[model samples]
Target: MIRLLLVDDQELFLQGLAMILESQEGLEVVGTALDGEQAIARTRELQPDVVLMDIRMPVLDGVSATAAIRRESPEPPPHVIVLTTIRHDEAVVDALRAGASGFLLKDARPEFLVQSIRAVVEGQQVIAPAETFDLLRAFAPVRPAPDASILAELTERERELFALAARGLSNADIARQLWVAETTVKTHMRAILTKLGVASRVQLIALAYEHRLIEV
Candidate 1:
């Protein structure tokens, strides 16, 4: 089963979402938290595989809570998918910077939410709402770049794949653009992630911007 911990300050919405998710096969709502502080505590106690986190909450906000969970959890920390109303792009970017696996709109369809959770657990990346690439222009934390040297460890094909992925293309999209198998794209992606020392494609995209590899 895919264990989940839902965190939101809104009690009613939280309960409703849990009911919807629990009805789906393969997902179990292991616990719920009303604020970020409780989220951190429940995460340690319940050990859920994924955290559906609310970006804004009392006591502590989701972004700060995400960073704390990543820092404090033992190896292989639970993946975090932050919930957002999305009026503030900066907060979403901050959540990604804090190690959230992705962000999902608070009103996202139930099917999409389930897909995102499965994708993260299976070692895939999730960026949502289709235009998220342009939205995440938050300053990249890095020095001036050759772009080439920062990505020196990558092969030419990997570099190409990296650029495509950094632009928010899904693996299937990248494969179609390159005329390769989707599995081939996934293989290169794994190599790129390993060589770059990043955990997810969201982090890969962050690094690309930080190093000025992709022109803003």
Candidate 2:
């Protein structure tokens, strides 16, 4: 079962979302918090597997809370999915930079919300590639050209796979596109992560954008 914590200042929305999530199979609403401060306290207590965090809240906000949880928590920190009303808000980018696993628009379909939770838990990105590209293009800061030495670490095939990954292709999709086995894709991804020094696919994409590695 996926243990989840819901964080939002809106009491009604918090309770309502908890009810909906708890009713789904394989999900357990372990706790709820009204703000980021409370969310941090409950997280230390409950140690949930995932946190559905609101971007704005009283006392503390989701982005700060996510940073705290990720930086201070023990190994296997809970994955955070920021909830935002605005699709292209800069706060979404801040949240991701602060170590959130992903973000979902508050009005996202119930099925999509559930799928995002599962996807994040399974080490996959929830944000669509196109949307992520747009977000990066709009808000990501300019950086010096990507380090040639760093780029040299990846083989030509690995670079191709990394470019596809930055474009938001799933492992299965990448495998199909490259006419390789899913396991092969997974192996390549592992190597890519090690080479890039990134912990997740989302971070890899972010790094690619920050370094202007892909045109996106």
Error of 1 at 151 (Å): 1.0
How many clashes show up per model?
A: 0, 0
Residue 151 of candidate 1: its Cα lDDT?
87
Give each prediction's root-mean-square deviation over alpha carbons. Answer: 2.4, 1.8
Q: In candidate 1, how many Å is residue 102 off?
A: 1.1
lDDT of 1 by residue, 38-97 (tens): 999999999999999999899999999999998798888899998998745678778887
Q: Where is the poorest 10-residue window by lDDT in model 1?
A: 129-138
Q: Estimate every model's Cα lDDT from 0 to 1.
A: 0.86, 0.89
Candidate 2: C-alpha RMSD to true structure equals 1.8
What TM-score, over all chains together, does every model reach?
A: 0.86, 0.91
> What is the C-alpha lDDT profile of model 2 across 1-216, one tens digit per residue?
999999999999988899889999999999999998999999999999999999989899999999898877888889999999998888888888888888899999999999999999988898888888788889988577864455679999999999899878999999999999999998999899889876578778888888877777
